[model samples]
Target chain A: MGERTIIPFGPQHPVLPEPLHLDLILEDEKVVGAVPSIGFVHRGLEKLVEKRDFNEMIYVIERICGICSFIHSQGYAQTIEGLMGVEIPARVKYLRTIWGELSRIHSHLLWLGLMADAYGFESLFMHCWRVREKILDIFEETTGGRVIFSVCKVGGLWKDIDNETLKRIVTVLKDVEKETKKMADVFTRDYTVQKRTRGVGVITYQEAIDLGAVGPTLRGSGVVQDMRTLGYAAYGDLVFEPIVEKDGDCYARTIVRVREISQSFDLIYQAINKIPDGEIDVKVKGNPNGEFLTRLEQPRGQVVYYAKGNGTKYLDRFRVRTPTFANIPPLLKMLPGADLADVPVLALSIDPCISCTER
Target chain B: MSYMPKSPWLVHYDASSCNGCDIEVLACLTPLYDVERFGILNIGNPKHADIFVVTGSVNEQNKSVIKNIYDQMPNPKVVVAVGACASSGGVFRECYNVQGGVDNVIPVDVYVPGCAARPEAIIDGVVQALGVLEGKYKNMVKVAK
Candidate 1:
């Protein structure tokens, strides 16, 4: 039934850096469907929670999405410390799990250098952003803002990483894990990156859990799920695990973000060798009167953060569901019939930030 | 070196940002702030650009595709803009379909303030838009004499 045409693709193309738009529906170079249209870069920011309050709304939910800005202020400071119960200590949950696994290894090496500059492989996207500028120089040497790291705070962590800066952030994450394993072996054994991501856009594990896919596109379809092993904060005494990959395509979501950036450098070297020294924050006194619902694992997936405090200091809603808005209906169900030159690497293999899906 | 025109090209335009200054303006053409070693490339058409750059801000569905890609470049072109929500609409400047920065719609020379502007300040705002693209090509060859 090949007789259709509509192309669009983005709120600005060139392998889209953000503002999404999709549309597609072609038939010539194949792709028979894809609607997608997000609010350009919506900054209603949960309507700035009725004018910033629950402690300055964690800098407006960490600017919503500057590459998962410190896990959207650590899931809105762990849902305003689980609605004002506030117990943040154990060195602020090992410094927000070592700055949330170093902002999930700089948002999975900035989505593997924007999916190697969206397939054209411009010098493997400049060696995957020169190993992501040493993870943005370990996030501007422990959060002074290299990308909205207002250092997560709602009951904990404004800044604190001593022990010689956690031994120079484990010697700059072992030289950013040896330059991200030589750029994840040229993106998992290159051959023009497995001929533009093997089996381009497959999605199956029951269509990624009946299309409600989350994180690593539902752990690259094997579905082992991972809101950081659902342990929250210090990942319930560390030792995490979730990098699955059953080849749901786009080369198993780029091998589950290159093995979760070497499992976020062994969970930031077991959170800097069992970090435990005490008080990073915990002085909250009021406001934040209930209703929580948090969730984290960001670097592109599983980010729900609903909060509805109604006990003053501006009590009200602050919703934020962003994993590119639950992976855009599984990225429009992996863009039908595929090949409109694999629609910008299947819309950048579900890493479409779209200002965290219209903040 | 000889009236500098050694590859300026550029044309990145994401009019309603938050892809953190469009991934630091594609991290200034990678290789650890290469800025294509001053030949600056980063192209994707805008009538074969000259140096438009832009990042984000000026919304309402991308302000007429940012003035139709700054009127399809190819002039003594030079824009820049970059970050802090493309200089002004920084934090999505009071939302509701922002209409703030990128000089409220166009005409910016080189703003590049940060909020996501680094990559060595977008290669010093593309080397200050290569000195405003060599003074708008010496005022368009003095209005073609």
Candidate 2:
């Protein structure tokens, strides 16, 4: 081995949209180990439960990660609703699933764009984001906010999507799926993309499970675990299978996400077709007096939320175990023996959301 | 002041942002918004950047980080604090780890407000930063005499 050297990759880096500082110990061009540090974006949001009432805390939680904002609020509301034994109406569940799926699609597309950019495919990155903009337009039109959507309230959603708008959403999704397919082809078949991603960051199935990997990282290792399968919201009423790939390399992870986008699209279409007309919300009574833990599938992976209520408007304690936190170990496993030049691609493979991980 | 030799070079740093503003900041560089049309290029190095765009509130760990980036930037540099978090710490203002807005660390030339500032507003902030850059340029030239 050549003389060992240290290279710091981020807290600020062009390839990463979020802050994830890693100290890579390298021998010549190959990384031998990595020391990771987070908390740069930690706003101590969990502690804000004491200041904001449980009702308003959904807003705080939604800000955990902008790309996954809707799902954060959805998970928060669902957890609190569980703590209070509040059973939401069927329509509310369906609406939450729809919006949640939209979050997944846009988030996955954003990752795809970032990955393509990491491969130095600028045109692909631009096109991927161009398609994603339509989803953002859908969000702005329906939710009135693009990034930090505060649509989820404790009892139910703030507004109901009209049937006309729902139908239009279906048509819009059809176009999005068509365009996503083109980009998916490039991600899968392109020479440079394959050169950069495939076989680059390999984690075996046993290693992924042992490392506590979640989301695409675990699924890419051929693990068939997805929190959606737990039947939360409309997932119980809907029929779909989790996408899994066996290679557990960067390519497998990318394929898992690409396939999941189409799955989420189909799930949305399925929900719209089966959505029953009913009251959007129900009367919620009394403060929560118990503790509850919930697991939900975020685009990145399964997120765990634990909430404790003390018979008041405010929660006693609130905590989240974001997927990035779980995936970081697996990321560390992949770093050693990697070429320094492939560090960015390896980092992006985990779809690290340091903001959510820290919050 | 009449014409700049080139469009401004921008360096974006996420101080303590939730990434809402950071994503929108990136959205500004993408196809629809395409800040590149105005000749703005997003660069990674602080020393080469003329405009420093920061998102989120200042926190304990990133406070020194924000200052280091600002100090590395050449004189006559412009800092645009994007989103409500960077402007005045917004909702996370009361968080224990957070120290408040970006201005608490570096001088801010523009402040864009939004829970997560919209791309339209972010692009507008960049345009506004350009004007401030030109003004600073003029002041630096005056000092040279």
Candidate 3:
């Protein structure tokens, strides 16, 4: 097995829907080492921020990665708001929390669908996405876009959710919760899914922390840390604990995400119930001053945004440390020694967003 | 040969995108609307593929690679431009580094429109491409006769 062949697993692969090239040194069917080459989707987003005004930069930042669009926008906006020392309205914070949780549910459902497809569970894939479409519909109705919800503005949200709209959201989410529970039962308890994912890509608790894995990937490894626990945006008011599992395997990550979706549902319900009546946003007087750092809990993990703004309409510098970028090290750790056939599932478990990583 | 719908293996190439369109492209292959049922499966190598699904607008750094991939695909292959960015540069059209839609680099057989085209639209475009493939195959049969 020492005399092994090196195979390139992507830049283009059917099982992996993202543009990532992994050179896998294989001994028979098992991977000995893996080298990942990204940047296929690098759009020069960081450089583009220099050209746009800080106000207009929200749209650009939101486009950095579509899967975590809301988080990117929220991070950038929060950074600018922090620099400006602008306290966002309470109502807006609750709204942001609701939208953020919705984004999480949709993102996890999408991951579940992709993982199912990777393991040849075609029916489960379709069923998961079929439910996901309902979430997208909600996004389209609330934010006016399916993937890039450009709803986060500098001071607060771009729009407000009326009581009627909030009621509708609650009603819709209740139905979604029931269906999702059934799906979670299948994903967590089903023999076939467990066999394919359990004990696969096992990353120990110490290894996950050392590798800087975030989101469900790290939480599955028994780390109860969630950036949202720090109380950004209305999460402080929500009563919940970060979902954690001890196994830290592919199946554990799946369970963490499935359970987290239910948690998001409860968080959204709380947001609707506790949302106070107030102005959605405050008028900004001038450009933001000084450097600001903001961290937000995205569906994938913790996303950090830093902005240094001069006393001008355009920003001096803006940088985003996306969750997928942080999880890459952990991905590299888990890939070696695994069967070549399991590469796609392991990759999906971390939920690599190449656009986010490269951006 | 009776008309067997040749399920052309698809190779996805991301030149420069926000990944909104990339995820939607994956959605096309996922279960709710299984594109594989039509025999279209995603392959990682360009040499083993018959269709190129190019997402995002082509960037200067990736232009050569995109062209190389397009050329590597076997002759009689089809290229489908997915998403607004791949179709007309979408939001990133005005960026200096962009070379506009994928058509600037390769001939596209079909265009799936949307900032990030929906999975349903992607399925429609792929089905339409299959029809085009059948037409081309029939022409070859006619020439052989």
TM-score of chain A of each: 0.39, 0.99, 0.98
Ranking by lDDT: 2, 3, 1
Clashing pairs in 3: A12-B44, A13-B44, A14-B42, A126-B31, A126-B32
Best DockQ goes to which candidate?
A: 2
Q: Best lDDT goes to which candidate?
A: 2
Per-residue lDDT of candidate 1, residues B18-45 (tens digit): 6677777777677766767767687677
Candidate 2 lDDT over A55-140, as tens digits, reads: 88888899998999999999999999899999899999999999999999999999999998887899999998999999999999
Give the chain B TM-score for each candidate. 0.35, 0.95, 0.89
Q: Model 1: per-residue lDDT, tens digit, A1-359?
A: 77899988767677876667878889889887888776667768687678667777787677776777777887888888888888888878878888878778888887887788788887777777777777777778777667777887888887888888788778878977987898888888978789988988888899888878888988898989887777887887888678888989988888889998898889888878888887788788978887989877787878788888889988588888877677788778778888888788888888877777776
Error of 1 at A320 (Å): 29
Model 3, position B82, has a per-residue lDDT of: 89
Task: Score candidate 3 by DockQ.
Answer: 0.51
What are the runs in model 3 whose C-alpha is more than 4 Å off?
B1-11, B29-51, B72-75, B93-97, B120-145
Model 2's alpha-carbon lDDT is 0.92
Rate residue A327 of model 3 by lDDT. Answer: 93
Q: Which is the winner by TM-score between candidate 1 and candidate 3?
A: 3
Error of 1 at A239 (Å): 16
